[model samples]
Target: MDIDWPLLTGLIGLCGVGLLLAYSASGGDARALHSQGARILISLLLLGVASQVPAPWLHRLAAPAYLLTVLLLVLVEAIGAIGQGAQRWLELGPLRFQPSELAKLAVPMMVARYLSDRPLPPTLRDVAASAALALLPVVLIAAQPDLGTALLVTAAGMSVLFLAGLGWRLIGLFGALAAATAPLLWFYGMRDYQRQRVLTLFDPERDPLGSGYHIIQSKIAIGSGGFYGKGWLEGTQTRLHFLPESATDFVFAVFGEEFGLLGAIGLLLLYGFIIGRAMHIASQASDGYGRLLGGGLVCTFFVYVLVNIGMVSGILPVVGVPLPLVSYGGTSMVTLMLGFGMLMSIRGHRKLWPA
Candidate 1:
């Protein structure tokens, strides 16, 4: 097994925390625990398989994988299962998975492969081409009305650009352009509920029992935990069902409420270590493809943690981003673990491939 021990250990630790939180959040439901456990095992299996694959193979599959994912996204738009008021999943009989989850890996992989053979600090033409590659799927996903996943996919592709030595001036210009279009996006791009969510972030109390309910309850649950938490299964908010999405997006709040500040910090430290280790692997990769792909995947993973923690902690709008391994979900677990697997592959195969 050519595994990266530190990274794998951190992942397993987070998964364990997830199981603990899931059990508590579900009020000790055996079925929920079993299902989540099964998913974790499957995700780990995929990670193991991915880690064994060579970097060159990943480089070869990048374009095809990306194209297939985009095709799936289009299929999602045409004939997809609608869940939670969004068309994001594609159900093939007993198998139901989110194509957008695949985008998280595909977009970055495709971008990294494209830029690898090109010059560093990609020229205007190259940047435009890369942006098109990213935007195509992003547009398709946004049309699915899955703004969260769309934004995440965008971030994943942008990370590749950033890692490819994209200039600071270009980045600043892009930032300014995004800012300038914020109003247009607000008025024309955002749905009513999405706008409400953003507004609720500033004043969650405004809707109290309505639009603000989730964040407001999450804040109370987290705040009541104080420094040492209320202890496992003793969380009033979770036990009494005051908290919503306790087993999914808001699971972190349940964790904070049960385990307190110390546990939260410990969990974050574990996450930090995994991210740091992945970055170190990326830094040591002998090829541009390996470096960009590894770095981009890790950056996307960082954003996942940031957005989920930010939303649950009342710092950002609730965009339905799960708390990585700790949140109870299947596709997300698989996608993230697969990314880690690819990182391990990059590290494990460094000596075999020349720069």
Candidate 2:
């Protein structure tokens, strides 16, 4: 199988950096680091398997994959395990996994499948059908009260639409509609805790010991890091356990506090390179499905980085979005690797004309 070495290199670099930061954030404990290592190995194996699958098979499987995920989401509401005050997980004997993560992959696949054969710019009916395919998963996810995952899943499908020749006017209209509905979302759609998060974004100090604690501590950790940082394993906020979710959602704060501003920029540059490579692959895609799937995955990856960093830096409300490939989590890592593997599948399975 053909390999995209630069993309793999970027992924490996991020995973390695993630391990180090996770270890540091754990106060020299090797448990999280070790778990991350195992996850990386498994993720790579999955990537290999996915890379060998033909694009046509993926296209054919899209409908079934999406339908299965939809069923899982419904099951989640019925009998799923609850954690962090949300029913987002399915428990089966010894295995537990989030159905919402499946939507991340399936939504894009189905959107691409729908638009691959249809001529675009899509007609109004086509747009409505695509929206139904996308919104069904998004609405189900929001019902679980997992806003971050919901938004990401929605973006995955929207990215496909955007790449499928959605018009600029439609884009602007959607943007305006979303803005107009923001207040309604805040009042009726969002949970009380979620609303508090938004309010805290403007002034975290107002409730330093309540809903605002996380961002407040995050800002402290980041700002405390000077030019070259306080040195690895020397981040006071993380070591002292003052930072919340340091090894997961706020791992960037651990990185910043220890490596400083320069290191943060370097991390961003690494992510930028990864996204750039994905976009390049998308540009070279052999079909509409490949193009839309690749571009959507890349866009979703961009949002992961943007949301995680934005929340940590106090620029956006605190959401439980983990740093892509850099945060400690098995599900997120595997979900992302699946996308990358599909990307490689497209690249490797393309028909090459004789010179």
Candidate 3:
């Protein structure tokens, strides 16, 4: 089998956890479990198909895929469905999906493709071009006010540049520039509620029933779990519906409240193993494009996990990043699984690529 079993096993384990938690969070709602299960199956199937695609094919498709995704994003801006106070999703007849999710893959693919043909440690011009490719969709997504996806897309593209051996001096310079623009983004780019989320992070009690409600409840649930947890389906916060978005963004809190500290450690270890295996695969790539794409995808996945856990634990401001493979969402699940499939493709097709 061309499949990387350890990575596959780790992914399956997380999906299983998701199903379990979803069942509990929905208060044993069979429809919710079935819906999530169907999406997982579809995503896994796509992963299988994506794993069989050759590297050259992936490289060949990068530009067109990216262009098409960008176009879709534009279409979204014009006619996208409004949901949850944001115009982020597009509905085409029977289908409804977020173009921002596709941007997560497309931006990195485009960046890796551009950088692979250039010299190692790209020149300023090359870096500028790659950043442009990245920022185009980022600007569009951010305009949709999907700040979380915008940040992830930015991370996705930037990870490719970093993997291409962008220098420490340039990294430092850009970091400073970003810091300098932070206040501008806060004042000009952020919406009112977005600003409130940041403020709520410091003192959730400031708006306990408003912007702070989500994180505050999340913290209480996680803290109540203690060492051994309250036990499966026995989570008081979840059972009583005190935790908001229990099946989606804040699902980790429900997990903590039920499974405790030990379960959380186990979950993190599983994530670590998957990340370690994927990085190893990336390291073994036969060509620069493979390395860049694989590494960038892995880094994006890492950020997804980090941000979700951090937000749930009340350590970071809630930016609405879902836990990879665990959060109950079709678009995020499909996007992540597709990236993993590409990682598997890099591993499977390495020897076939030209040196």
lDDT of each: 0.93, 0.91, 0.93
Pairs of residues clashing in candidate 1: none
Output the better candidate (1/2) by TM-score: 1
lDDT of 3 by residue, 1-355 (tens): 4999989999999999999998999999999899999989999999999999997788888999999999999998999999988999999899898988998889989999999998888999999999999999999999888889998999999999999999999999999999999999999989998898899889999878988899989999999999999999999999998999999999999999999999999999999999999999999999999999999999999999999999999889899899899988788999999999999999999999888
- TM-score of predicted structure 3: 0.99
lDDT of 1 by residue, 1-355 (tens): 7998888998999999999988999999988889999999999999999999987999999999999999999999999999888998899999999898899999999999999989898997888899999999999999889888888999999999998999998999989999999999999999999999999999999999999999999999998998999999999999999899999999999989998999889989999998999999999999999999999999999999999999999999999899999999788999999999999999999998776
The parts of candidate 1 lying over 4 Å away from their true place are none
The clash numbers for all candidates, in the given order, read 0, 0, 0
> With candidate 1 superimposed using the best TM-score fit, by how many Å does residue 282's alpha carbon deviate from the native?
0.9
Spell out the clash pairs found in candidate 2.
Answer: none
Candidate 2 global lDDT: 0.91
The Cα error of candidate 2 at residue 329, in Å, is: 1.3
Taking all chains together, each candidate's TM-score versus the true structure is: 0.99, 0.97, 0.99
